[model samples]
Target: MASISSLGVGSGLDAESIVTKLMAVEKLPLTRLTTRTAGYNAKISAYGAISSALATLKTAANAFYSTKTNLLTSTVSDATVASATSGTSASSGTYALEISQLAKAHSLSSRVAGASETMGTGSLAISNGSNSFSVTIDSTNNTLAGIRDAINASSTNTSVRANILTDTSGARLVLTSKETGASNTISIAVTDNDGNNTDAYNVLSNTNPGLSQLSFTAGGNNLTQVQAAQNAQVKLDNVDLSFSSNTVVDAIPGVTLKLTKENVGTPATVTIARDSTGIKKVADDFVKAYNDLHSTIVKNTAANPSTTLSTSTDAASTASALTGDSTARSIDRQMREALRTVPSGVTGALTQLADAGISIDSSGVMSVDATKFQKAVDTNFSGLQSMMDGYGKAVNTLVTTLTDTNGVISARTTGLKDSIKLLDNQKEMLNNRLTSIEKRYRARFSSLDTMISGMQTTSTFLTQQIAKM
Candidate 1:
């Protein structure tokens, strides 16, 4: 009938301590569940490490499939005159390139005119060789600044740019051709609504016998030429060629030339060659990545007996998280098989990876012999390429299977997580049962303590009665 807190006071017994000991015994299942959850978490972490290593290996494997794997490098002898770039289609060759002329943009400036002065209501027709467009100059946009804005806003005004140049003399309207070819010439004509007062158009046009908007000759209103339009002149291997743009790609096959400055006499040598260094680096990276993956597998799956008398001791093993795991073992075995087995569809003495100078040691580490690889590549480049392609394909396929959405690694991690969730649920249920058991133990102990207290009180009263008699 007594409460748990008052049980010890009634009979001088440690009832709460006894209930704690009973609850400890009842919570054994919770400890097991906790240990299992920890194991599952460790396995998930181990799978994560494997996934990261596989991702690195996949990247290295993908490099072999790239067209740029046998990429070419280009160099220009005189960088001051020009620069060069090569693509996959480029072959190893040399060319003597001379830049006779650099492409120039056509620039023209109007005669001195007040910056704020209105040009009057009219339309100005502008042409760039093949295409012609008009800009309407209304009262709102008749000023120099307004006309500049209007020209920029015209959708059809693609070949020319307009700017107002302010000097000590006054402000002038400058028009420049957007393109750099001689064919891209600038021409302009004015149509005035106020025929007599065409000051805006006159200030910017040449008033010669045949008045033109682009000419900067005498009889013009002091209109000056800033820079004339010129086509880029180049001599490739002594043959003259002209280009509309300084950036020429068609001058040489699979090569793009960027002309920097005009060198009438000086020639810049351009060369394109196979990039052996790049190819070798890719091969080196593959070997390193392969070795890294192999090492990780060995470290995680191998057993250690140094820690104790038992050869199956887990404490001394490097892969505590993944020790004795079947999935880990399977991954290691598959990777080893991929490395050892030669790809199918090849018939030659150089069919295996060892023929290409890629060798694996007893410790599961891979290395490439540079001299042997170079000799193999020089003799049979196609064979080497095919071998790497086959090997990369096999590795890529295996990696994808293990790392994909429904992959073994992913599924295993998910399973472990689910197991941990189950363990958590089990722990919760065990804790609930233990809580109930503790409450029952306390209730029973409290009742026993109350009964003992009552019996002792009865014994004490009887002894007092005997003494009085």
Candidate 2:
């Protein structure tokens, strides 16, 4: 028997076209599986958007629970004399603050000498309060500039800073205590290699030259005290208080006072009070966050209203990614329930969010009544705080459960993913089966074409024999 080279040459049948059409029908199941998988992916993406919105809402809700009271703001009548800041521990009150003295750091100067003149080589032991460090002077670093650099570069020299000051007299090595306080006064003891530490009697004496010129200890008077270390003294309501530093924090409860200048006779009033603006801002943020989350849920779960027109470009139809989905519906229902339920363990006239001037409208959007909210904050701030705390705790708990690792949204997403995976596996199996079916169809058509060609040849032979007779 002869084999058919082309599909339809012998039988005059369009076998290739027929096989293609049959394969198209056979692929219907794969196409359906792909479409279903795409739908599942869309649902998963919709859940992701919902989770992000819920996370934002959770942050805003947590803020309300954390803020214990209205934020406090402080002011000073004389900002030039002093500035103040208040913290959560501060109580609303006014204090008459009188700054008699600002803190000063101790500064000492070495006897004037030539800018590049070298003093005798030795080691100088320097101290401020309990901190002490020694600087060695050699021929290489014996000059005034060299001594300044050596003192500053000492790794353990934490209490004092050294600098070279040039005047009409000459160059002087100036040492200043790094901190304020009489106890932080600087003292320098010298081991003069020249063997005469007390030989220099006057500030201008360079004759008995040695490292003793830089000493300011009781045994030597080579260095002069330029500035005295003193404490900052202030009077709060006729009570005297002193601090080692100008920035006073412990003197006032929950308040830090920064003394800039002395105003002994004239006292500045420091007032700390509740900040109404800050409270209102927090309330507004909470409402806005809830509205955003609510909007997202509504958009994802909204059903398209019945329409007579077949072709419609309405947003309602386009926005439905998880429409009729049980997970989306459950989340929406739980959130609405949280809003309607009254928070437990709350007391006072403003026990609920509505009582504190926060209300949800029929459209599921929250609104704040500014006048009412401010009135509640002014008259019953404690009550308003309690209500916010209660509501915030409740909302935070609900949002956490919904967006956590094993949350409803996460579970739904996981289920959708598993469904897509199954659909993909099914699609693979269906495609493999369709391949085998197409091969069988092609083999049968080729055999039929060869058989028909042989029959046509036999018919032609019989007609030739009859014509001869």
Candidate 3:
């Protein structure tokens, strides 16, 4: 009739220990499920690594496509004079670049006056190139600083930037054209409210007491031209060329020249040629990418031959999850096959990767032969490029098939995931069964403990009676 708080309290037997051992046996399936899940997860991670490496390889291969393989480099004899950039359309040639004058933006300075001096109310029409905007000068914004702010804040004033420059002479309103070139000259015309816009009497005045003094037009000469807007003049290959801006793009096909300084008599030579180093690097990168992908596959699918297995949980310590996996094997096989197959539309001594100085070793690692590759690039650049383009197209197609939604890798990953989900469900059911088994074991052990305790008490009474007799 007594209630026991702890297991095995009423009996000499260790009921708790027995129940724990029984439960451990009952939960064996759960442990197996856990191990299987871990294996599946490791497989997924291995595939992820392969996917990443394969994607990089795909990118490297894509660079060999016909549209992307232009590797021209431009060089300048004198960087101080000008720097040049060549594009795909640029033909290999040498150009004589002589910059006569650098394009200048038109800048005009008003007569210096007090920073807060109030000028007569009027409207000023500012023109730069074909763009023109009007700024109204009122009592609210008639001072030199106020006018500068108003002009800058004008919604339509996109061609000119207005600022007030303070010097010992005084504060002068400076207007600069935003664009450079002769046609972009800044001219300010005034509509004075005072009815005397010319202000010829104050033409030499530095104060600019009226808005008319701000005019720099045919009708009036008020604002002084600090810098003129002139086109950039250059003699490219002894041909005089004029550009609106200092950055000349149309002067040469696919070449942009940035004129930094004027070198009138001395001409700097610009050479456009095939970038042999860049071309070699591209070839090297393709080979390296393949090697990396190959390494990943090998590492993931390698067989562990040691009899003594590692107990470490680290993924690297254990046999790879992808070991003996059909998908991994197929990927490796397909990739190697792709490398061995000759690219279509490519003919010559440099038709295959090996011909272009890329070769695979016995261990399935690809390498580039620098000497041979350089020779191929120098002598058979077009042929090498054609081979690369064809190979790139083939490899890219293979990778796309392997990594696509319904691809081999994806299907394998999905199958593993499904297996994991099923295992998880089975584990849940097994856990529930183990929970019931533990409850039954505890109940049975409690009953056994109660019986043993009652029997022992009876035996002790009997022994006392026998001793008394």
Candidate 4:
């Protein structure tokens, strides 16, 4: 074989150019395969967009049909006094609420005289009526600030929070219960074992005294109970109820009541009703999502202007990559049919989307007639829900068929991938064949160049020999 670098050197013929031209012709089939691979890849991407749009539509439809979408609103005449939250289990009703007192946690402040004083080098034990935890008071945590930090850092000290308050006199230790219930009343006791120093131990003991030391009259310590640990007191419709916490759940079936202030003897009316605003928003979202999906389908399936036979040519030449595709056509057709047909599970006057103020037009896009929808919601709320639920099921089914693992989109994607792989194999085979052809062409052209050089040499020899004759 002749070296590629010197193939045309012998005959001065442009053999490299000739071989390149031949190889270009030979690779025609590979070019076609490459083009086909690109087309398949583009189709896969188009399907991805289609599937994504359908997924959005499916999510909206599912939300519209959910039973939990039946929203309820709680209205308190005076939110300043109290507020409430309502769920699906809550029933529409009015209740007269009179809050006698708000639940409070126990708070105690030590005497202001020795406010900056540190006490006790032993363990401070706290009891929450039933449970007890101890905070160690060594030299490292012997000061008022250290003891406060030790109490806060103790894993078992979950029932109470120790704080230090500073004023004109000095800083005093303040202790408060973590819970509001009466059973969570904080009991403080101190025991000193640190022989190094008794100053911290003595100070803590003087401030807290003991669990039975409820009065601040002993040791000049002003241990005053700022607030008592008490349960919330409320009279609902003149019926009394008590709770350990201000936020009460199941106080009225599915309603949660939060007492902000005490309004004794004065009644605040609380009304629970169906939340029309929330329900309407769900419907509006459904319409918007459907329109978005419809728009995607229209844009992708619009025919080129040259191919259009109808009067409509809003989307002219430069048709989408998905134009004239059967899958695109199927999606458009099925979506329209699903939106148009009344749900099989729904009955009565509010059976169709249009009955609930949602209408689909020739463009296959949905719009909400807010006035009519509100009327339908007010007139036959349950019936409207049933219609939406049933339609949502149908839309979900369509999306599942198209986007599922064994669905059309997956199958099409797999097919495109296989085609690309096959094209790759064809490209490899063509490349191998071109390699052999290039080798043969270089050798044959080298022989021709050698023959032409020899022929010119022989002609020059014959002319010299004839001139000598």
Candidate 5:
């Protein structure tokens, strides 16, 4: 192997040329990661724009879903209002509730067959002839835990589960048959229980919720038996809550309350409607979301260069188009009105957003008084509902206008994506051009090294001739 210097080349300049060529390869990935590699990057900017637009559209869609324009108007028309319950606002001691309907339930019990008792251990084997596990009893094995462990160790995917049955005497072990499809059962065939099958084993029953009533003392805590229902029972810190059938479900946050006609006379008319607090919260949320979106758009698109909001060329263009463009502007206007509109049927304090005690600051943000807004809803709920009427329809229309494939936001985003794609294509071509330029430079250096090597050989031969002279 000849080094560049050994090839009649005085300096390792050709080696430096290889180093420079390698540097170009290292820059390829770096260029991809940064905008400094600008002109050569394919439509990354457009891709970024489209991705952002998609994200915004999805976010807006989610907001639309969270919003409910329909009236929180669940009416408890009929009910056996044994004792009606109504929610109370912390504002006025008006927590007095009238149940619109009584709660209903079904008594639960099973018609399972009784069992025969069986004792200690046997070579319990699943269907396979040689596959089996043996149980050893040292008298202490009579306990439930011991039986459970023995069955589990039996090697079958099936477990030896036990249910404790209650009778006048005490708890008795009810073992289950592990196989599936009804025929699986524990069969005690008088193998060796002091000769009598009756004294030795009792076959367990699988009829009920396997072991519906099992209580054990683990660490001295006595677990009680109670019927557990699939749905959580509604309660406020454990105060059993009853709800009327006509009650609005979301009126309670993280809880359920019953409706019945208790306080309201004759027909037990409990207003199974949205709780004032919950409704106000929703209204407040809508106001905040609308305002937040408005502010974000304004900041992003604002003509002022001093603002900290993103005003990059693409972002600025989008902002301008959104603010001035009729579709974006129109939809934005509708959303604004939707948040401000009041339910026609509502009355009492603060009819409009202003009356609900909500106000927008100069920066286009909403602020509201928690106490005052709640009080207005509690006393005159219908009036408040009246104000919120048209907003739902308006929002649906706005969402369609902004997020639909042909909507304003969608159109702008699509255009941005296309433009970015084109820009990126141009960038890729430029990069290939740069690679060609660098490669040509390396080839020129290779030719120069060859020329230098030839000259060095000729000079060495001349020097030898002079020495001979």
Candidate 6:
């Protein structure tokens, strides 16, 4: 190692310890800056936490609002009502309505089976003049079945199939030409190898022999052709209309028509009645959603946001009160006011939420009485609908608080981020200034070391001179 005196002559520090001590003293400002930065970061993190929590809460609020309002809206306008029978609105103590749609039927065009086919348990050889091939028929081992599978397996020009009405009085083997538009006809000359049926080989075509009429059980909708469209002349609420399709179409409001019978036994009747399922479902969904919102509020601001009362308790209350703020209750009052105010231009069935039986409690949470709810469904659904209608504009307003721009969470988060950036800038400035201070301190230490080394050398020279004397 170089001598301490050499260190002093070179850079001015008599010893490294002197440089270290001064440097530590100069670093104090930097240490203070670092502490400030740490504090800033912590504040930013806390603000971020609050912003994120609010964002989530805002989302839950939106869903809760949408569900309750939609349920109310649907309950008012929807056509579904349970407990009402197929016909007669409220004529029976409990009844529902269902409308039926007509079924579509299709007919097949009889064309020549141009391709060759094996029929009725047999290995058949097919020849159309020069071109010929033999096909073995098997149902159990091979997925192939009936004459249709065999002919389809034949040459590309020909095809095979089965007719449903084969046993009918006009039954005939009518094979269709694959290319009826171009080729127009198919010729099949076959040699059957089934043990008992040798004479069954016949060329299938429109000219040779028509496939026999089909013989089978007809479905509930009889194939029997009617001269005109089958319809029942019925009075829907004293209004006369023809019922032709199933799921009876409603001729008027608050009614559903349905087919109670098909063909024969009794004259198929059309039932007209009121529907209540839509309203009841709305009320149920509203209750569930309201409870969810109430729970969220209680959890976030309550002694506990997630307080759930024990089932064994004499009274079970959901955690619903807003975070220690009675304002939450005020908010509910505002929501109720919003619900009560119905804008014009409403249409169909139920008109309001109150008509449908949705109400708010003093605590700001919605609470539904099932009995009152069902009674409203049974008696006046439009009133409940009106109550739901009041919330539309208000909900829209509340949802704005959650938007990414100008939203409660967004604004706060953005401000925090900016503060963090500023803090970071401040920290960098502090570091730069401290670095300059440290450099200055180092320079001063170098000068002090030089002075000390000069003194030490002078002392040595004096000692030597004095010894000579």
lDDT of each: 0.76, 0.83, 0.84, 0.76, 0.44, 0.43
- Candidate 5 local lDDT, 1-469, one digit each (tens): 2435332254336556474767667566545534423421222333334335434543543433343333233333353432223332211111223433343321122112243322333222222112233454334443445544555655553433445465664445444433221122232211232333342323223322122122122321112312211222233222455432334344443222444334434332224355555565566666656665666555433454453335443443333323333444454465566556664444555456677676766666667788867776676655555544444344555555656677666566566566666656766776777778666765666567777666777999999999999
lDDT of 3 by residue, 156-200 (tens): 988899898998878888989999999998888878776665443
Winner on lDDT (1 vs 4): 1
Q: Which predicted model would earn the best TM-score?
A: 3
TM-score winner between candidates 1 and 3: 3
Error of 1 at 181 (Å): 3.6
Residue pairs of candidate 3 with colliding backbone atoms: none
Model 6 lDDT tens row, 1-469: 2333333465444556766677788776666656545544554454444444444444444443343333321111123221112222223222222322222222233223433322234454433223445555554312113454555555532333323234323333333322111112123333333444422333243332212211111321111221212345444334445543334433533334434432222222233333455445544554555455445444534433355445422122233222344433343344456556654554445445544456666665665566766776567544444444435434546545444587544564576567767767877887787778767766676666666667777888999999999
- At residue 385, give the lDDT of candidate 1: 66
Instruction: Kindly provide the TM-score of model 1 when superposed on the true structure, using C-alpha atoms.
Output: 0.80
For each candidate, give its TM-score against the true structure.
0.80, 0.73, 0.87, 0.73, 0.44, 0.38
Sort every candidate by lDDT, greatest first.
3, 2, 1, 4, 5, 6
C-alpha RMSD values across all candidates = 4.9, 5.7, 3.7, 6.0, 13.9, 14.7
- Model 1, residue 11: C-alpha shift (Å): 4.1
> Candidate 4: where are CA atoms >4 Å away?
1-17, 67-84, 91-100, 110-125, 129-150, 164-171, 189-224, 233-242, 250-253, 257-277, 295-348, 359-364, 369-371, 393-408, 446-469
The clash number for model 2 is 0
Name the runs in model 2 displaced over 4 angstroms.
1-30, 68-70, 109-124, 133-159, 162-174, 193-209, 218-221, 224-226, 264-266, 307-319, 325-345, 361-363, 397-469
Pick the winner on lDDT between candidates 2 and 6. 2
Tens digit of per-residue lDDT, candidate 4, span 124-180: 667775668888776576666777788788897778888998877677678898889
Evaluated at residue 378, the lDDT of candidate 6 is 65
- Give the winner by lDDT: 3
Question: What are the per-model numbers of colliding residue pairs?
Answer: 0, 0, 0, 9, 54, 69
Those runs of model 6 whose alpha carbons end farther than 4 Å from true positions after fitting are: 2-110, 115-262, 267-278, 294-359, 392-469
